[model samples]
Target: MPDSASDVFDIPADVLQRETARIFRGHGLLPNDADWVAEALVEADLRGIHSHGVTRVPIYTERLARGLFNPRPNVCVVRQGPSVVSVDGDNGMGAVVGRRAVAAAVDVVAETGCAAVGVRNSNHFGIAALYAEQLVAHGFIALVCSNAPPTMAPHGGRSALFGTNPLAFGVPAPGERQILADMATSIVARGKIILAQQRGEEIPLGWALDPDGRPTKDAATALNGVVLPFGGAKGSAIALLVDILAAVMTGAGFGTDLPDFYNDLDRPGNLGHFLLAIDPARFGERDRFLERLGRYINMIGDCPPAEGFERVQLPGEVEAGLRRKHLSSGVPLSQDILLGLRQAAGHADVSLEL
Candidate 1:
């Protein structure tokens, strides 16, 4: 059933986690890996970014069953320099590989006050904010970028030539509220289009082009077509930068050779991610910096609203509020995604409730 905008759906957070864990375990993921993956998916839902939430569980399970993803592959730091490290994911689950990379970056930054880590051969690791927030919790500023399978075309091109190329940045604050910005270079992330298709809704024009290279609003057709960059040349330029940093710099798959995260089971996806962690204390007095940040934030917040707007919000503020509300209530799932999850569970010999 399609959910009405005002209609609320609620499930206990623990129940949602357990359901996800069950789904992952049934797909042959180890207990620890299942837990971490479940947490990441749930975190996305809590933050109201349903595109990266449990809706993707079925896809992940399908990839696992098709032998396209390894549930028990090795993840190791292959090379380490003074302030840089490279990790090989060995076709493992992306949640595991991504977490390991973040952990390594955290460790390096703790010692060197700054560190950059590149990971290759990983899978879809969900929201970039998850990794950035991890570093934020440790009082370090974090920047993360990932290269996806090519679904976006570069400027002046008619065919797909670049990945959506997501980027995320996070900074720790004095209080519980951390500042974060996460977005895809495209006009819309593929996950959002997927969600629209699943919900049988039409997307806005200019969001994507049909396979024949014409503007389209049909979500299903858009999936086969190319997603436009956010601001034309500017977004396309950023996508190129992400490709350089996340794919070329890390020696992972790039451009047309990037593996499709959804299908194509023949080869390893070789998704690449780049992460940086920087300790504020190393640059100046931490207390003073935070104080200044707080003041700046207040100034932004105190700006007068325009038209029907009530207030201004800093990056991540809306998401943080949504997360708090969802945690107490429940993360809403579209009926289509719910059915897909049930089907995946059945295939894995696992049971799902509603």
Candidate 2:
């Protein structure tokens, strides 16, 4: 462990994944389930998405231990049609439920060329890109979205009533150059503020408002308050759409109906997710679609960068570059996060040096 919480540790990705898996297993997750969740979390760290990465381990394990989320879930399929499926996550961790839903979609798309999956009774699923990329790898265009516990107010409201709903999209292009876009409707995810609070750091001025509805830069104040939407009303509208599709349509909690994941340890997080997969082969020739998408990708890549920017890059290009660099250099994690991971590991009698 580092001498100070501010110190940074660059641990190997595989090592972190293995240790995290062990920690989760110690918390009662089955071996395969533990591995899957650990891999997704570490992959997010590899891509520089720390807010959705292993920093979440402490809360996740705590929730599991407290029975706030089911460590072992049945993940039953409630309904299915030719191309649409509805899943009941059985109050499991969202990462596990989301993967199971994606697997069902992949199986269906293999025969139907398209599949829409709605998942309810789930917990937080980390990041939507985790599932979107899975479909993209299977030669499908993917759109994935999820509704979280309300942390943002509606467009003009003051009290928290809308979630920082997130959406992710992915399309296979050429080689390892596929397009993957993931973002929250909020100015920033609440997890970022939570992380800032954990690190004793201040947030940017515009990220959130205090409980009094005044904009605040204090992380703790922001957590007690509400986060702002990304593009004002536009972002709010997108969030509404996500809630409708992911929560309302999926029979999950929405708006004030959902329990906050961090504060509401007494209740399960009844989150929801919507996953759609479309096979290019269904529209026409898969190769032809890829060729056209390749041309489109080239067109975007050729665009000149504006001032203050280095170059034009696709949606996931920056993160992909970061992943390539970090894979060998190791993943940079703050000692604060390391401390939390250490405590979590100790609970399971697992010793982690990093």
Best by lDDT: 2
lDDT of 1 by residue, 45-137 (tens): 999988998888888888888888888878989547878999999988888899999999988998999999998989888899999999988
TM-score of decoy 2:
0.97
The parts of candidate 1 lying over 4 Å away from their true place are: 1-8
Residues 229-347 of candidate 2: C-alpha lDDT, one tens digit per residue? 99999999999999999999999999998988888889898899999999998899888898888888888878899999888888998999999998999999988888889999998
Q: What are the lDDT scores of the predictions, listed in order?
A: 0.88, 0.91
Which residue window of length 10 is worst by lDDT in model 2? 153-162
Best by TM-score: 2
Poorest stretch of ten by lDDT in candidate 1: 1-10
True lDDT of residue 96, candidate 2: 92
Q: How far is candidate 1 from the true structure (C-alpha RMSD, Å)?
A: 2.1
Q: What TM-score would each prediction reach against the true structure?
A: 0.95, 0.97
Task: In candidate 1, list every pair of residues with a backbone clash.
Answer: none
